[model samples]
Target chain A: ADVAAAQAASARQDSLTKPPRALGRLEELAIFMAGWQGTPRPVIDRAQALVFAGNHGVCAQGVNPFPQEVTAQMVANFDAGGAAINQLCRASGADLSVIALDLDRPTADITEAPAMSADEVLDAIRRGAGAVDADAQVLVLGEMGIGNSTIAAALAHAVFGGAAADWVGRGTGVDDEGLTRKADVVARAVERHAGIRGAALLAALGGREQAAICGAVLQARALSIPVILDGFICTAATAPLFDADPRLLDHCLVGHASREPGHTRLLHEMGKAPILALDMALGEGSGAAVALGVLRAALECHNGMATFAEAGVAGG
Target chain B: ADVAAAQAASARQDSLTKPPRALGRLEELAIFMAGWQGTPRPVIDRAQALVFAGNHGVCAQGVNPFPQEVTAQMVANFDAGGAAINQLCRASGADLSVIALDLDRPTADITEAPAMSADEVLDAIRRGAGAVDADAQVLVLGEMGIGNSTIAAALAHAVFGGAAADWVGRGTGVDDEGLTRKADVVARAVERHAGIRGAALLAALGGREQAAICGAVLQARALSIPVILDGFICTAATAPLFDADPRLLDHCLVGHASREPGHTRLLHEMGKAPILALDMALGEGSGAAVALGVLRAALECHNGMATFAEAGVAGG
Candidate 1:
């Protein structure tokens, strides 16, 4: 009751803009900013996606039909500039940076693939986030691990302390029976890491890419940068990060509502509003890249709008 | 059970895209285009707002301190392109068209305000909607009016056949006592027009602009051009139209879930989603105009976009 009263009072207090009631819309937006780290108005000096490319161990399950090699192939596709997420990011003015976080048994072709321990992944993320100029903000905390959803689900279960069977879902649209098997696999993974919490959960169940994203989200929040959270996989991994420190939610903006039912439920749990509901299940932060334009437009509208009082019109 | 089954089947039938499971992110956009007049993938070549500008008869109750003149001034503000809605529409590439429907008394000095009766409003709406190209769409809606909430409550009571007290709210932040007075006035208005259905309710209490908007929404639906709905005033008029003919739901897209509490329950009654939860209370079709951009992006993404198969990428 005390918290509710405080929130209500805050909601009313934030409505006080310069010249009283003028710029009501912008005033409301400023109130929304109170929940984030950025100065009430976030200027996107730079929008970047750190694609944590990796092949997951859970692909051994029949949960996903795609071959594990596609993870590296897609990484090469991103590097060669052919992936759809790459194209969309380019179109939307996002710089794509790839980190070869993990491929437990590396194939012969890509020998340069960086083998990162959980701590190394964290260090790399902090380093990448540090590379951004102080004035500019990193907008996307994105992941690109093949079969990472299983890893994400397990990590999320441990982080938020949810049941593995309840939190686990049909990643890449497995059948009802396949879903049961996937749940069992995730439950075993979660049980194996039951005592672990926070960053440890990432090391146990989190993919290299997922751990890197956790680092980026944490670093971005520390720097007051806005992190655009993509669909289920990204949210699943980051849920624990937020649970570890609720302040992390301050720097995040929900990119889009994923078609996966768990995604919207998780977003609601986190008190986020997905700017778009475009049913984007294709990962690699495709939805986040697209959502940037909408947020940009929203900010533009919030800033550029001529208030009713400014227009010398009487209020209704 | 029967209605749920039918809706489920309708939902399934709406998912038939050209290439099965190819354009994953883009396929969900089909729901927005499912009931358009043109081909399934309708081009939103031009979008227009049919703003129903009027003043409620019940404003005489002193619920709002602003004289009814603000309605006409705001309408002129919209015409002279000074209102927030105007700025937003200009930002979003929408044509602003205004109609002066059934204002009880216009403030002097506003030039050439069209005084439309219920009949004229219906005719103008049909004609205005028809003027747009077949591929284009229109959102028929209302903006500000003194004591508009009272009028809406009366209209809702008449159409949804609920008690007027159920729908009345704090229009423009009336005090608790003022709200009681406002509700009483609407209840009286509802009694005066008791059992009056559809057009007669408009003739009795609905403001000119709201009547025009209602007419436009129904005509647009009949003509098969999609109509995106806004807040309470527009929605109150909608009940009568949908009550008159249930088929109008086909062409409708609810833009924002209004800040007015009545709207959520109404939307649920109509079974709508993809609601842009903007918490918007200001009308003038601003919310719908913003939603139009979202819908346009969805349509464009749907119609344009190489399928995973087309792009020769392995499905994730």
Candidate 2:
């Protein structure tokens, strides 16, 4: 982070027409953006949102309510601009891209073996990293996969060392029976991959979309582009990076708290607070896209509001 | 609210490609707007934001840090499109207006006597009701007054039967001494007018802005326009109406939870959850304006997203 720029932005906020820190978290957000953009006044003229969709092999366990084919079908819906993410991106002024990662070739079901080989994880990461637009001022990362919530639960349990039930939640809406099966799948997957650690744990229990989110986060950080992470699945996807290095998420914000029970716990484990808490659980960057509007409002106020001196207003 | 339209909107949400309730509060918000707009798909093409500015004679108690003149100065800043509210409204695509209420004449010092005569309060209410634009799909109500926080605290204490200290806060940056003085002033004012009740409490303890907010809220409800209320001062201004009849606020949504310690308690007392909680305390309708973006996103997703049949996607 650019300390000098952050300091400058904080100083500017105090000089704005409003009371000192009256804008609360908005002042902190503007300063955070200033540090990332390396400018006292930062603006997001170009925002990019990426949705990575992949089919989860864990569907063989009957953990998810939706069929595996739904992943590819949702991707087609995204392409047709008929998905929630499409409408959200249009409303938030974000340019969106949908990337389907080996939908026809699902990873090995984690209940039986590692979800992906090390090479496969690396390949997905590369694909995610390559999708970043260097010119974009901000990035929003989300995912779409049939059984990824179970994948996310297994990954969270592996990294955070908690009860499987604590990390499992109904992804897209599941019945009581499906919920029980999902918890069982998560428990079995985490116990099987208990020995794996760090980023390799992703290979053991995570899917392509998860690895891609990690890659995209890394790429955005490399290019000094701040990222807004989506819901539980998205947060669990990048947990490996956070576990490896706490500073890895310094340029990111959790977009919203999801209705999925594990999402709040995962966010707490990561010591992150989401920008919005509308209980949204859709994982197509929808929450992140909505939060983009708040970020834009923060920047607009930061860059457009006249200083006390400029407005000839008295400061308290 | 049109129950039929709300039901229709809720039904439409279920048919959307995403999981049931995946959009969470956004779905509820869309349904609420649909009920208010009397349509299954609501759009906010003509949102109106009204900021009522007034001068408080309660400043005689040294309850505020800024001079009363700053209220008028900020109004001019707003007119010049240089304040936070102006920038936020521009970013959120809301039409903005500033109504300065007899700024040349400050209200009576509430510690000594009623803040405004009953006639004066009614006149202010009339002005407020007159300010509402009939064509507006949604109304955002905010206020600007130098000592309004103290006024809000007193009004809340008078209406909600709370301890004066519980309703007092350091509005717009006040030192420990000022906070103590503000609390003392609230106690004295509430004690002085112990018999006041319902809408009459506003005249005894509130300023013109508060009365105007009450009027605007009533007018919006009469016109079937949903209202998004600003922070503590604005909320406290309308507390009298809520105290009179809980149903009076059915058309209203608290835009954001304010940093003022009393605001959250006030929201709890009224059983209203703010749409956003960015810790914002600047009350020029700034928080409500920011929430307008969220509301717009909800409506856009509701109106624009393709249904399961349209997208040819499978439902769980």
Candidate 3:
């Protein structure tokens, strides 16, 4: 991060027409952007939103309510501009793309074995990283997979050293019986993959979409493009990176606390506060896309509003 | 409010490509807008934002940090498109207007006498109501006044039966001493005006800007335009109306929960949850303007997303 630029932005915030710190987190958001963009006044002219979709083998355990084909169908819907993320990205001025991560192939069910081979995980990550636009100022990451929430729960439990039930949640409107089965699947998967850690743990319990999110986040950081992470699935997908190094997420913000119970717990474990908490649990970069509006508003006020001296307004 | 339209919108939400309630409060927001707009698909093509500025005699008690002239100066800044609200409104696509409510004449010190007589309060309300745009789809309300936070605190304490210390806060960055003196002033004012209720209570402790907010909110309801209220001062201004009729704020949304200590308590008292809580305390309709972006996103998804059958996606 550009510390000097962040300091400059903070100094400018004190000079704004409003009272000092009156904009609260907005002031922090603008300064954070300034640091990442290496300028006291940062603007997001190109925001790239990427949604990675893959079918999960965990569906064999009946953890998800939706069919595996729904993942590919949602990608088509995204292309047709008929999904929530599409509307949100359009409203927030983000250019969005959906990448289907070998949807015709499903990872091995985690309950039986590792979700993917190390090489397969690496390839998925490379695809995610390659999809990021070099010219984009910021990246928004989300995911689509039928049983990815189960994958997310297993990954989170393994990385955070928590009970499987603590990380499991009803994804996509699962019933009470489905919820119990989902928890059991998570427990069995974590136990089967015991002692696996870091990237190996991810390969053992994560989905292709999850691995891709990790790649996209890392790629954005490498290009000095700040990232906005979507809900539970997206966050859990990056948990292994955070496990390796907490500072890996310094350039990212969790967009919203999802209604999925595990998301808030996961966010708490990561020591990150989401920008929005409107109970939104939908993935596909929708939460991050909606939060892009707030980031835009922050930067607009930072760069557009007159200083107290310029406005001839007395400061307290 | 059109119940049929709201019901239709809710039903449409269930049919969207995503799982049920995956959009969470965004779904509720769209349905609420539908009810107010009397359409299953609501759109906010024209949003009007108003900032009311007034001078406060409460400043006489040394309760404020800035000079009373600052209110008028900020109004000038707003008119010149150089203030925070101007930038926020521009970013959120809202038409911005500033009304200086007789800033040349400060209201009587609430600790000494009622802030305004019945006639003066009524005139201010009329002016506030007259400022609303009939064709606007939504109204955003905010305020500007030196010591108006004290006015808000006093009004809240009187209406909610709270201790003066509970309502008083360091508005616009007052010091520990200023805060103590402000709380004392509130106690004295509320004690002197004990037993006043409803609109009379507003006149007893509220500034012209506060009363104007009540009028504007009522005017929006009359025109069937949904309202988004700014921070503490705006909410406190409309508290008396809420006290008069709990249903008075049925068309309104608290845009954000302000960092001001009283604001959260007041919101809890009113049983209203703000759409955003970014720790914002700048009450120039800035918070409300930012929240308008979320409302816009909600409606966009509600009106634009393809249904399950349309997307050929399986529903849970």
Candidate 4:
């Protein structure tokens, strides 16, 4: 962490006219942004979202309401700029890129076997890492995959240390039967992959989009870029990174706490609070895209406003 | 209520590719915007915030930690664009207006006497209402005051029918002793005005800015202008308006649920929900200003997004 920059930002914060800690979390976020950017003044002036679209074999287990092809259909919608994330990104002045990392093929059913071979998992991570824009300061990682929440649940159960009931949620609003089936699939996958951990556990129970998201998160951290995470699916994808190195989370921010039950559980584990609480559950980085507005606002306040010394306002 | 426009907006929402009510409150807000704006395609393109600054006599009861002069000081901060609301307004592209309605003197101690005479209260309301801008489409109401939480708690307890303890909280992080004292003061004020209701209760217990905010809410409704409400103090001031005509709520949107305890109680009394839950209590329209971002996003998606028919995507 850039302690010197954080110190400078804090000094500015205390010099503001209001009482100490008058701005609350908003001020804390500014200091955090300063340290992350390694500057007393930081901005999310240039932001980009990468949508990693893929498919989950758990769809074969009758785990979701939508067909697997709907993933491709949604990807097309993102491509044509018609989806929720597209509108949010466009409205908030963030660039959007939809990448079909592995669109045509679904992962192997994790309940019976590993989702991908070790080599494929590594390649998926590389592909995810490769998509981060070198110039963008804030990188938002979102995903579009049908029945992927079940895989996310399995992954969360493995690395994040939660029961299937806690990890599984009404993904895409599954019916009662679908919910039961999804839980069963997650339970079986967790038990089958009990001995695995880290990248091996991710490869055993995670989706291609999830693995790629994991890679993107690591790459962004390595490049000293701050990452904004979407809801349950994306959070589940990055669970391995957070579990392995808690310090890596200093580079991550939760865009919103989704209505997905497992999302709160995961957020609790990460000890990172979301910037917005909009009850949004439609992933594909929709929460993160919407949150770009708050991020930009925080930056503007941190960098643009006059301090008590400058405004000639008395301190309390 | 612009029934035709609302129905048209709802039709567009249904025609979108997502499941019915899949977008949840986001779609509801869009439809609500259409009804309020009298157009199927509604946008909060031009928004403004009016911050009414006043002082509370409740400070004499040792109900707060800060001196009353801080209210005037904060007003200067608002004018110089150094306060939280100013920075938020600048960041979100909202016009900011700070009115020192009655800051030179504090309100009368509520436990011993009425905060304002009936004529003064009526005049305060008129001043609040007169600040509305006809050119603006979305109007946000916020306030600045010291020891105002005591008066707000009293107003909420008297108007919204809640226990004084239930309505009281630490404003600006008051110590435990200050909170207990504030509660005692609110309890006494509620007892003193036990027989009064509506405008009489407000005039007896409210600060000048609260009365003005009450006037602004009514004026916005009379002009068919949509209002975005700030936290506890403003809500307490306008409680009487909400009680008199619950239908007026159709034109108002709660910006966020303030950390102030009375805010949730008052919101429940009005049967309204906030757009965001940022846990902010800075007042001065700060919550409303940050919320401008969410409102703009909702409007953008409502007016600019393509439907299944427009995008040629399959219906779910």
Which candidate achieves the best DockQ against the true structure? 3
**TM-score (C-alpha) between model 3 and the true structure:** 0.99
- Misplaced by over 4 Å in model 1 are A1-51, A70-116, A123-138, A257-259, A268-282, A286-294, B1-28, B34-37, B79-82, B100-142
Candidate 4 lDDT by residue in tens digits, A1-316 = 6899999999987776655665666777788778877899888768889989888777888898777878888888888878888888987888899888677878888878888888888888899899898778888889988888898898888886656888888888787787888888899989988878776776888778888898888888888788889888898888777667777668888888888889888888879898887777888787888788887777677776667677765544
lDDT of 3 by residue, B1-316 (tens): 9999999999999999998999999999999999999999899999999999999998999998899999989999999998889889988999998999999999999999999999889988999999999999999999999999999998899999869999988898899999999999999999999998887886898889988888898999999999999989999999899889979899999899999999999999988899999988999999999999999999999999999999888873
Positional deviation of residue A302's Cα in model 2 after best superposition, in angstroms: 0.5
Tens digits of per-residue lDDT for model 2 on B69-181?
99999999999999999999999999999999999999999999998998999999999999999999999999999999999999889888768899888898889998888
Considering the two chains of model 3, state its CAPRI-style docking category. high
Per-residue lDDT tens digits for candidate 3, residues A28-129, read 999999999999999999999999999889899888777788988999999999999999999999999899999999999999988899899999999999
- Screening candidate 4 with a backbone cut-off below 3 angstroms (N, C-alpha, C), the clashing residue pairs are none
Candidate DockQ scores, in order: 0.23, 0.88, 0.90, 0.53
Better of 1 and 3 by TM-score: 3
Instruction: Candidate 2: list runs displaced more than 4 Å.
Output: none
Pairs clashing within candidate 1: B52-B209, B101-B208, B102-B208
Candidate numbers sorted by DockQ from highest down: 3, 2, 4, 1
Which residue pairs does candidate 2 place in steric collision?
none
Question: Which ranges of candidate 3 are over 4 A from the true structure?
Answer: none
TM-score of chain A taken by itself, candidate 4: 0.97
Candidate 4 error regions (>4 Å): none
Per-residue lDDT of model 1, residues A263-282, tens digit only: 76677777877766766676
Quantify all predictions' global Cα lDDT against the true fold: 0.60, 0.92, 0.92, 0.81
